[model samples]
Target: GAGVSQTPSNKVTEKGKYVELRCDPISGHTALYWYRQSLGQGPEFLIYFQGTGAADDSGLPNDRFFAVRPEGSVSTLKIQRTERGDSAVYLCASSSLGLAGGSQETQYFGPGTRLLVL
Candidate 1:
């Protein structure tokens, strides 16, 4: 894809249900990030992956949230025991050399997946 792309633009699930959000980043990008945006707020960083390993996951709210990048191209964010408080827009972004920390790199963002827990 030309830019980052996420699957299932919208998802609605009952409380305690499990959900998986998929993100396919631009081809060849090495750095991927996941974020969450609530009403009237900016996106909050959740995790960042450099290749298949998670470089930073400190932003994850709790143990219930997890993300993985298996082949370094596609990533998935998994949520266990979803709650109404989890309702938000989940965003995915990718950059070619952002994690290198030499120079700032622009990250391409996807349309995001709106998750609503009832």
Candidate 2:
């Protein structure tokens, strides 16, 4: 069972550029979530998916941020028109479904994709 993993643990880019961060969740996980955390702040939920559909995406800051889980496994977060304010740690997590209606789950976080906008 692989835990959540993210690529480019550190990314440095200029303003107005585009970046795509990848996440690989644990096997057999059907619930996936993406969160962004800024300095001295808690992780803000970006999007959540059950299977291949986005169940929640209200946390996305703007149109510049988008994510997809096409196959219901690996997910990618794409950021367009990068801004210095976008610099933060992108975290991905997954969990199992309990007997309850929704998944009674605990998120297992990845090392995180750290993006730096210069």
Candidate 3:
């Protein structure tokens, strides 16, 4: 599809557990990003991918978070040793091109995956 979609709309996990969130971006998109949003805060960028390579990953909180895109299409965000504070909405977005001219390009966001860690 030419639109973004995420699997497992909701996830509940205990502390120290592991979780994987998936994101499927538009068919030909070359730029992909993952963000996390707290209860009332806006999404904070976690990672960015250009094609299948991670263009930027400095936004990830720590080593427990990771993301991958094998074919430059579908991406997955993996979290290890989940903590209660990790509970939030995981958002995925894709755009036709990278952030070349700032926020002028069209970026499509998927309905986020709600993760609750206890």
Best by lDDT: 1
Supply candidate 1's per-residue lDDT for 7: 95
Residue lDDT tens for model 2, 1-118: 6689999899999999999999998998889999999999999999999888999999999999999999999999999999999999999998866768375788788999999999
- Show model 2 residue runs off by greater than 4 Å: none
lDDT of 3 by residue, 74-108 (tens): 99999999999999999999988645744467879
Q: Report the C-alpha lDDT of model 1 over 1-118, residue by residue, as the tens digit.
A: 4788999999999999999999999999888999999999999999999889999999999999999998988999999999999999999999888545722888889999999999
Query: Which regions of candidate 3 are displaced past 4 Å?
Result: 98-103
All models: lDDT?
Answer: 0.94, 0.92, 0.92
Cα displacement (angstroms), candidate 2, residue 25, comes to 0.2
Query: Whole-model lDDT, candidate 3?
Result: 0.92
Give the TM-score comparing model 3 with the true structure, all chains together.
0.93
| Ranking of predictions according to lDDT | 1, 3, 2
> What would you estimate as the lDDT of candidate 1?
0.94
